[model samples]
Target chain A: MDEIRIFAPATVANLSCGFDVLGCCLDTVGDEMLIKKNDLGEVRITKLTGQDLPLETDQNVAGVAAKSLLGELGSKQGFDIEIYKKIKAGSGIGSSAASSAGVVFAINKLVGEPFSPEQLIPFAMEGERLASGNAHADNVAPALLGGFSLVKSYDPLEVISLPSPAELRMVVLHPLIEIKTKDSRSIIKQNVSLKKAISQWGNLGAFVSALYTEDYALLGRSLQDEVVEPIRSILIPYFDDLKQVAMDKGALGFGISGSGPSVFALCKGNDIAQNVKTAINEFYKAKAIDFELHLSEINTEGIKILE
Target chain B: MDEIRIFAPATVANLSCGFDVLGCCLDTVGDEMLIKKNDLGEVRITKLTGQDLPLETDQNVAGVAAKSLLGELGSKQGFDIEIYKKIKAGSGIGSSAASSAGVVFAINKLVGEPFSPEQLIPFAMEGERLASGNAHADNVAPALLGGFSLVKSYDPLEVISLPSPAELRMVVLHPLIEIKTKDSRSIIKQNVSLKKAISQWGNLGAFVSALYTEDYALLGRSLQDEVVEPIRSILIPYFDDLKQVAMDKGALGFGISGSGPSVFALCKGNDIAQNVKTAINEFYKAKAIDFELHLSEINTEGIKILE
Candidate 1:
């Protein structure tokens, strides 16, 4: 039996103004998978460790993506799979993305890396599809390639990695709650007012411009979300207050991370990061909600194997 | 009278996926202004050098911006203004923006450069305000800065720049018909479907990312307008066919330059530019509409003195 092991990084999706367009990787948290080829011609889950997760590996997002990829190959080999989930699932830290990305990456290496990064996006999106039943690449791209990435097109080869600022330090805060990506997605309106769209695009344009120019102030200004944030924010406790506190603490911007419960704040320096983290923690404490805070630098190098 | 000359470059607003977020400057054609400080204590138009234009200088778009800036300063010194409209008025290639930017630039110089570029954006917005009755800076920023620019916040302070690909060549075609910016803006739906918005944002995200990576193919894939283009495109003759012609001729992408009556195509090389120009010219000849073709580079030097 040939065995392969791979890792994929966590990501923050719905990045402020980017919504479905932007995402970035995070270090120190992700999912690891080990796969070995067998002659059973059936996929089987051998073990699961770290973080309470589902045992039905076929239904598991990362395992599903791996199984789907293997199924598509029409290979007459069964696979033994083990998942070491490090990132807290549904924490809005791209927990599922790390799993999906890791599984696909491990499977690809095990079978000889046949597809390009672009080619793998759809396969990764399949994992996303299993998770949300809707295909999106904002999370998957960053999980695949570390650094700032964009989901330009989603079908017939999704696009990734537009211009990103070199100075990116994102501080994420996860409030105590489990918010499904589907539930968060559902809360959003089916239609958006054109006036709001214009404002949203205006900010998105500024965000993109700031990335190219390294104008941190402009990035701060453009980090506004008038469309999705306002609607979905209702799901998070003390959402508005948290944002105000983070901003008052000198955060460049604040937005709901991925499908919510977890919120991310963008800052300029380590001092700002520390300040934002402290402020966000204080906000949660004031609200009497138990939560966790992750104050790390932007994980420009996404997923990698651990020695 | 102290005569001073100022020039403003043409601009392409709503660059594909950017919609209201992104725009860039075109080097080929623009508007020019000659301002003469006088003791008359009021702005007066001494000459109109372009094609038939509003003779009442006060009502003119450029004149409005210039007058507003002067009014804000409360200067008793009068100014005699001469307008040289090189970029065709009412063409989608940011005709209103050139006037607004040129007048603002000329007035700034005439006033001994009283305000910084940041301060001048609002003044220029005044000109756009006169033209469209709404103050927006998507066109004005690029007209002022030349390369790809963003107005994260339409407020004067939040304007910034994004990266521009070095190999960008713009092929613009005007079919001689005038399309008012106001009318084009009105035709767009005041509401957008959420499904469409996701697709739009996805493309916009890709477009912004493409700028950083200089991925031409991704740029092409992302160059889609589902909301504004579909509704407003009906106004342009052979709009779809022209886009096909330009794309078939090697244009990376094609869309309405600003509003309508004029269209622009983006291509990678000079050879593609030449091919697009010939293709567009043929479209015009086939339709029996007299038209003009422009092969231009992305103008990185926005507003300048043309002697």
Candidate 2:
């Protein structure tokens, strides 16, 4: 196949209790990308719409990601790419991850599928590096592998995909604001108390078990972040009020998605998610803020073919 | 049910990568107890053998645990307890936990079981509180619930029992040296770098997943301790050498069991465990250290009825 059209789904990273190690895919929100092979021996972003991003190969997450994959294989195979962005940049819902993971996924398919979905992760992570200062796997991993993904280790780059409960729904709230990855990360302390660290790991362990057992309440109880959230949540507008409302609306758990500007309320079923979305809307609407709400089921499949 | 004789299996707590929250029950290393209902409305220790311990109900761990269970139930029923101590007190394995969990287990059985085995955890933890200053449930939870247990929280006191692979075995090396839990704990820094904490939680999250999947190799990789081991291992003699030989001889993972003096090497099968045990034995014998070694399978039944 010389050309491939695909849907690169959005992802929620920096999960509560899980912090930098866990992420889950979103089904309803994503960007559409079209890639076609070119014999010119060059990677280029020929078309870009919906959001104004750089067209330079090195500057664009997709271009960087696609080049990483091609460079790894030593293939002179070039590709012309077009990204129709639906998920806005700096929304903190893995905007760059979608474009990055999406391009590598599409190119791998175009090049006779030399790499499996899981194998495409490292190249996708290059996009993450270009987007965020760190080459963290949390966002790109779940975006490629789908479901709930755990980054077991970083040196080896081992990521394990966990099974998501059938009824799990994510209600995402994005306020029209930008939180730069650098500035957002700067506020967090370099050190944490061991007491809080123990609590975080215990909750993280229980949270993983909850995923296996599909214990919704247990999952909610384990969705606590003792390390980063207390400091970073202040950067987002009304983070506390939103979390309180989400929990009161019977969300299984709630936390800042990635670094912030986007928040997710994890619910057991679509009905509760819809209710959470409605409650969050009504609560946030009262404030002088423009926000968007999305209710989505856990995406079992990561990226998908559009045509 | 007037007279009950039981085997209270020992447990390995403060597992690698797990630290304060994880533990597993052992099959062969434990203590035997004979508990009998008394006509007098008072708890008493009629006989104690194999070790010098306090006989007073309040001073004895078994007595404290038994009393805690009775006090919670508000039952006037009393019992005469006999403990034949086998597991050494400061061996890092759950010695106090065995005695503490055993009597409550036996008394519960004698009184037609007012509480389930899992319910007996809190009372058993009272014994832990008497033995140590903290009422940590890592040891006692597994001593009651069997197999592997994760102490999800200390405040609300939630414990989760996890599965163990069929062939899993533990080779425990109790070097004939005593290191008090308080002294062992003091050396660890109350604060840790965020980078190390992230690595710890990442490994812990993966370790929990490994338990569910019964992936032994993955379990080996996940058995890492960045926060506690470096400081604590200094308390144990030739700690690095022993771990090296155990790993070289094909043990799945190795680390300090609970605190110090006693270390455990986790192996996948009986054959590998035996090999690891032999290697460790040989390594320790050359040194001027006197040690006792025990090889045990994962005890799915925490406390057993011997007769």
Candidate 3:
């Protein structure tokens, strides 16, 4: 096929105690990209929709990722790309990751799947570097591979897919405020006490075990970020109150999504997820903040083809 | 029965990346305790063997743990305790944990198990405090609960048992040099950079997942210790060379056990475990250091009754 369309899911990185290592995909909020071969042999962003993002090939994450993949294949074959973005940029929900991963995924398919999903990570990470200064794969890995992912090492780029409980559901609340990724990251302290580091790793280890055993209570208890959240949460409005409200309304756990302006809570069932969403909405209303809420199950199939 | 004998297995704490949070039990080396009920309402250490340890009840870890359990149970009954220490002190193999946990296990049995294994953690921790100033439970938790364990929190004391693969074996080598727990702990820097902490937590999350999923290769890769080992390994002789030799000899992973002097390597099967042990022994012999080596499977049973 000379043309293909693919959907890449939004991802939640950091995952409380996991910091830069853990992430999972969301089923509903994502970006769709359509790719068609061009005779000019130049990769270009022909059209865009839903959000105002850069259309320049070098400036856009999707274009950059697609160009990187084509360069790896050593093909002069160019492609015209169209991005239909649903995940909002600066929402801390991996909007850029969806664009980057979605394009590489579609292009890989257009070339008869010369590279595996794992091989596409570096190209996608290059796109992430364009969006943010750092080449982090936490968001892109889950967006490309699906379910939950652990970026075990970034130096050699090792990513591992973790088991996600079938009953797990996520409630995401996006406040209509922008928090730049660079500013969000700059607020964090460069050093932490050794004692606190130990505590964080303990929770991280327990969290991974809980995922494997499907122990909901253990998972909830392990959703603590003693190191990062304490510093970064100050930048987000009503962060503490929102989390407390969600917890009181039966969210298993709650925390900021990625950097800020967006927050998420994990619940075991659809009913509790709905309750959490309502609770978050009520909190937002009382504070007089415009917001959007989305309830979704863990996206097991990350990126998919659409005719 | 008015009298009982119990054996608490040795443990390897800090398991590389996990530092104050993770530990696993070793099968063969342990401390055995014998407790006999007496009419006098006072706990006493009656006899000792195998090692020169404190005989005063209040100063000893076993005596301290037994007293704590009795206090919790509010029992007026007294006991005469006999200690047979097989695990060497200051060897970085949870010697104090074996002693502390063994007495609690025997005393609980004598009183018809007034506390579940997990409930005995606080008492064992009390014993550990008598050994080390800090009431750290990494070693004690694994000794009390068996197999691999994660101490998720210490304030309220939450400990969770992680699954261990059936084929997992450990080769522990004690180089016969004493690295005092206080000295071993003091060498570590009080503060760690956020970047290093993130790396350590990443490995820890992957390591826990590896344990549950039984991914041996992943487990090996995740055994990296960027935070603690770099500092503590300086105290151990030939630490780097020994680890390289172990890895070259087909061992899955190698790192300092707890602090220093004692180092352990993880291997997949019995043959590889034997090879690792032999390789460590040859390395020690060439260095002209007195050492002891033990090959063991992961102790599924932490503390056991002796008939």
Candidate 4:
């Protein structure tokens, strides 16, 4: 039985009003899943490292994603799955998605890559559903396909690639606290005002336009969120303080990452990005919150096989 | 006093959910306003002709726009304003905007074109505000600049030019009826569901991405309206039937123009454009509703001086 090792990048989804549609990959944070085929005809959860995780292979997100792929292949060969935890679980940095994406990507290659990325997204989303009870592709997409991605539809999933500017940089801060995706999604009101919705749509239009045209100024202006951020912001401690600090130091815009506890700031040049990282660090120091900051370029290359 | 003739093209504002953010110019339907500076301190409305217009220039939309521009310039020199209305009023073709836009475009030219197209939009919008209580720049910006324009901000108006696809074609049909912008806006709900707003944002994002990448398929799919069109569509005659016919005839998509009575369909090819036009004309014919159809490429040249 041959052995395979795969790496999947972490992602920030929801991107403020872009809820299920917009997402981008981050290079620094992700997970590594290693798989080896065996003749036992039984999937085994061999080892779990980094943060404490589920031991049962069936209950494991990465294992489930791998199992789904293997089931599709109808292979009699069993496999041993091992996950090296890199992105912290429940940090809103796509911790679970890394596992799912890494496993799926590795297994697809093992099975001769029968499923396209689009075809694999739903299976990956099922992994997300196992973790959050909601099938969301925002995290899974960027994890699978590097750079900026748009999930046009999720029912029968469709993924579209968006233009990524070379100079784009991201400053993300994860405050040590847990905010479940399901709970965060529940706190938001089911309905919104039409006037506000229009404003959000306008901003989103500008955001997409900026991305395509590579207009930095317009991108900064368009990164505003009048719809979801205002509601979900209350869940994060010192969100306002951290955001203000980041913006004051040259961040273009800052918003909750996925369903928060983690926050990301879009920055212009490296100078601004470094400044934003420092500002966030200072705020966390003052607040006495356990937080980590990462200065990352847009991950144009999503998942890759390390070995 | 120099006598000059200027023509401002008709415009479509609120292109989908862009409400106040997106606007575009149309080549054919327009209004021509002639301005002559006079020694008198009082501005006088001189003549009005074409397309069933008000004889009284002071009460006319063109006069109001011209007056606003004069006020902005602090032009103490009184002017004689003559309007040749080519576009019909209340056709959802931005008739008043053409007059208002023409007044500003001509006044700027008459006074040496001091203000840029960006500067003229606000002055034109002031004129638009007089007719419709809402101060929206969708119509005026397109009339002044031509092609597709995005309004980033309104308080201190900021407008940006968006890329226009070469093969893009617009088919506009004016259904003979009166639907005021205010009335059309009023019919929509004050608020929307957050879930629905997310859907709208997703579509808007896809639409904007499509515009930048020139992806016609994404553009067609993204042209959906979950909030505004469903409610306001009732006001237009045979709105559903027209849309069905137009889409079946090869329109990429169709939607109510501005505040309706007029409907516009987007198509990629000229054959589809003609087919859409014929389909719309047939629908109106069956309903015994008098209508006019215009098949135009996106007008890159906005307001111009007519020799």
Docking class of 3: high
Cα lDDT tens digits for candidate 2, B144-244: 98999999888888999888989889999999899877778888999999999999999999999999998999889999999999999998999999999
Question: Residue A213 in candidate 4 has what lDDT?
Answer: 83
Q: After superposition, how far is residue B49 of candidate 3 from its true place, in Å?
A: 1.5
Which residue runs of candidate 3 sit more than 4 Å off their true CA positions? none
- In candidate 3, clashing pairs total 0
Model 3 Cα lDDT, one tens digit per residue, A157-229: 7888988999899999999889988888888889999989999999988888899889998889899998989
User: Candidate 1 vs candidate 4: which has greater lDDT?
Assistant: 4
Candidate lDDT (C-alpha), each: 0.78, 0.92, 0.89, 0.80
- RMSD per model, one decimal: 2.3, 1.2, 1.1, 2.1
The per-residue C-alpha lDDT of model 2 at residue B301 equals 88
Off by over 4 Å in 1: A5-7, A50-52, A162-167
Give one digit per residue, the lDDT tens place, for model 1 in B173-229. Answer: 888887788888888888998767767777776677677778777777778988888
Candidate with more favorable, higher TM-score: 1 or 2: 2
Interface root-mean-square deviation, each candidate: 2.1, 0.5, 0.7, 1.9
Best-to-worst lDDT order: 2, 3, 4, 1
What does TM-score give for chain A of every model? 0.92, 0.99, 0.98, 0.96
Write down the TM-score of every candidate. 0.94, 0.98, 0.98, 0.95
Give the alpha carbon lDDT tens digit for every residue of A169-233 in model 1.
Answer: 77787887889888888888889997777677677756665666677877788888888998888
In the range B83-140, model 3's lDDT, one tens digit per residue, is 8888888999999888888888788888898889998888988888988787889898
Q: How many times do residue backbones clash in model 4?
A: 7
